[model samples]
Target chain A: MLEKGTTAPDFQLNATPDQKIKLSDFKGKNVILAFYPADWSPVCGDQMALYNEMLKYFSKHDAQMIGISVDSAWCHNAFQQDRKLHFPLLADFEPKGEVSKAYGVYDDEVGESKRALYVIDQEGKIAWSYLSPTAVNPGADGILNALEELEKK
Target chain B: MSTLKPEVSSSDHIEGSDAASITIVEFGDYQCPHCAHAYPIIKEIEQAFGDQIRFVFRHFPLQESHEFAFPAALAAEAAAMQGKFWEMHDALFENQYRLSDDLFEELAETIGLDVEQFQKAILEDAVKQKVEDDFESGVRSGVNGTPSFYVNETKFDGGPDELFEMLKESAE
Candidate 1:
């Protein structure tokens, strides 16, 4: 529901290592904000793995990819450990659906987040956002392509 | 025997071989209850078909709704690194609701992974990225839901009986 070029909503959530990650912290860098439903699904695993493989590309582009989910920090920690993930997965667990709602990825009917990807520019403006139905999966290349296009600006 | 390969992304490769003439590619989430429901049906089909068919699973975690799905996927991948992927995969689905951190660790221990190394691997950003890439691939291929299947590149629009019939046709 969020449009491109709109200001990304501000957020402060717990990330891995029991630290807090704030949206404003990356004020001068591009951020690939991905919202996924849960931790241990088939498509989600592949999706996160794709990003892990492309970590270098994101870094080369001076971008940070952060995944958001409603799982607890401990769950994220376990997930990160298990997958050898190279990115941070934030814990949006305390308020349960606050961050997801702010991002408009929350599925109120199911009490879970929708599959949505948001590309936030260095200035904290949303450069791109994609929302897929609960049953479909979203692409990492599309995100990379969007970032590439945004960098041309 | 017929062999069908599901479309794969540059980041992933399917490496199993069975003499089955039919191949089924499942775009599923471990966290989605619906997928969990389909799990047994897939198992039944596999048991019934055995070497006659091959089943491939692709990651399509709906991170929006099921909070534990993605991380649980990573855990399965980590277990896979130890050559215990299928074991871990089965365990995850069997214990879907208890996907807390403590539970993950317990599961790792139960599976005999080096707890310290396993923990380190899961926290590594690289691991999460791999899962992310899989997700991106799913989106690219127009997968919008869990338990979506492509039988020989033809989407499965029917239920279990329908899927079984398709499998039979593909085998022929």
Candidate 2:
């Protein structure tokens, strides 16, 4: 997985079937990239729902949280609507695990992205990264703490 | 991130003995179906374990997904003012299917609480702050979802069923 102080790899992915979101678009803001195994799974569903509630707190730190999975744009759209998620769940489709691979979090054996979190700073450097166990939901504290640390710099 | 933050104290709504061999803390949303599902399982666990285990419940309301969640938490805190936190907590989960703005008052009345006082308490900033504090504590404690449980100050990886199995094993 990517480490702190490393330049974050950029990518353009589908936030929706008709809308594409680029990593560069959020240059001046901190970006939270949460890569998980799949959509509709129990753990993933809970993790996303929890993040949806933390949007207010995330915004307070000038951060934009985005979820990434190998699911297609259409699948992300359905899941986001069902979960009522405020953040974008980008589809690393077509090329499949292309983006996940660049971040070194792609699970080749399962053909899914592992449960990983990356906090990219406003300068586009990896500020923090965590590779959580596939079944565990690694809550918001880490992200919040990292963001808090970034503010001190 | 896996340890229970601040630890359970007198400020928390608690069940069972402080001297109990095991401690279970749950960060739950009142209106979440999963939490409601865990409610009965938790009751069964409490009944099965009795004084051998202590249980604590903290609010982690996902208000956006469950509109009645924060309100229900506030109602429970309001009931806490009357020393009826457990009563309101049980009533909320038992009637989770019909949770709404009016249900809180009805539940308060059913719990034999002073309905007028309960209503007034829920509107107070203090009650709201208490619920928010619970949520902040949950976040700090690494609660990832509704019904997130901590056993003996460490985050338990599985659901209530798994917790029961672990407890049963230890008791034997």
Candidate 3:
């Protein structure tokens, strides 16, 4: 996995069937890249739901969150609508796992992104990163803490 | 290995003895069925332990998926302002199947709160901030889901039944 201090490699992924989002477009703002295994997990430990609730807090830190998965754009659209997720769930599909691989978080054996998180600073440097246990949600604190530290600089 | 961050303090909404031997803190979402399941078991645990256990409830609403979660939490916070948090919390869990703004107001009336103030409190920024703060603390404390429990400050990675068995074994 890529470590902190490396430049956050940029990628363009489908946010919806007709929309594409490029990571480089968010240059001046902090970004939170949440690389998860998939969407529509059970509700009890639903990571996406947890992040949805934290959107305001992340906005307070001036950070934009994006969830990346190997799922198709249509799948992401359905998941977002069903969950009412406000953030973009970028489809790392078509060239499946291409973006995930660039970030060095692609699970080759499983053919999905590992449950990972990255706090990309406004300058596009990786401020911090964490590889969470696949089953755990890896909640908002790490991203918040990283954003806080960036503010100190 | 998870531990409670920002330890339970006087500012916290505590429902049991301060000097209790065990402190069980729950980070819960009012709209989550899993949390609703833990609700009765939590009551049973408190009853079984009495003064031996101190209980605390913190909001960790997953508002994205559960539309009524934030409102439910705000209802609890508003009820707290009127010294009726437990009453409101219990009412919410008991009526989890019918959670809505109207239900919150009705619950407030049933609990004998100043209904007008409770209604206004639900929209207050402070009330929302309180819930948000609790959620932040839960996140920092490694709470990944509703009804995440901390026993004596350590995360209890088990269900209500397992927690009950553990507490029961300790008391024996």
Candidate 4:
């Protein structure tokens, strides 16, 4: 998986905003990239909700949060509407797990991404990265705290 | 520009009056072995902290690997429709492996749910959507796996005891 201080790889992936988003777009700002397995499970729901609840705090810190999954944009659209999600849920549907593989969160055995979180600094380098086993949720507040610490530096 | 807003449905908003000062949010899969292992520890933490801590569970089913997980999640939600969410939740974890359709019916029976209503609810695509929504939320929140949790919004990277200690300190 992507590691702390490692430069984030650049890629243009499909997003709900009706266009492609590149890593460079958020340059000069902190970015929280959350990789989840699929849409619509219990723990996944709370995870996004927590982030959604903390949106203002992330914004105040000049950070952007983006979620990536293998589900199609159509599925993601339905998910966003159903949950009233405030962030973009990127579609890693085409090219079949390309983005997930780039991030090293892909599970070759199941063809799905592992639950992972990466905190990328403004310089486009990874400040922190975490990969949880197949049955856990990524730590959101830890990412937030880490961001706060990094901001002080 | 990426804007952030409260992304959760109003119903899911957890309400707790605990001044214990610590909250743990878990993302788990019912059929997941690790989750089954973690369930008791979570219960222990809840018992240990009482009102001093808040514990929330989010669903992250690995559908590709665990075909029964999605159905199991729907069953729990169906039970939730009748105010039996916790009972069904426990049943699912307790009977994690036998998640087949027949077993779901048995669980529904065990949980005192109207078998017909439970079966009907399971057949409804919308009920599945509810579980799906939770999974999507997990993905959006950056959950890449199951049985993962956040301690007062900080990710806990250790075992149950490690998490328990962190929760204890955060409560202070």
Best by lDDT: 2
lDDT of 4 by residue, B1-172 (tens): 1111114334452434446576677767788887888888888888877887766666667654566877788888888777787788889998876767678889889879998998888878877877776765554455535666666655556556678777677668
- The interface RMSD values of the models, given in order, are 7.1, 2.2, 1.9, 9.1
Look at candidate 3 and give me any clashing residue pairs. none
TM-score rank order? 2, 3, 4, 1
Q: Tens-digit lDDT track for model 3 on A10-110?
A: 89999999999999999999999999999889766478877887788789889999999999999999999988889999999978899999998999999
Off by over 4 Å in 3: B114-117, B120-126, B169-172
DockQ of the two-chain complex in candidate 3: 0.56
Residue-level lDDT of model 2, residues B36-67, one tens digit each, is: 88999999999998998899999999887788
Q: Candidate 4 — which residues are off by over 4 angstroms? A: A1-153, B1-10, B13-20, B169-172
Interface RMSD of 3: 1.9
True contacts kept of 3: 0.70
lDDT at position A27, candidate 3: 96
Which numbered prediction scores highest in TM-score against the true structure? 2
Give the winner by lDDT: 3 or 4.
3
CA shift at B81, candidate 2, in angstroms?
Answer: 1.2
| Cα deviation of B153, candidate 2, in Å | 1.3
> What is candidate 1's CAPRI-style docking category based on DockQ?
incorrect
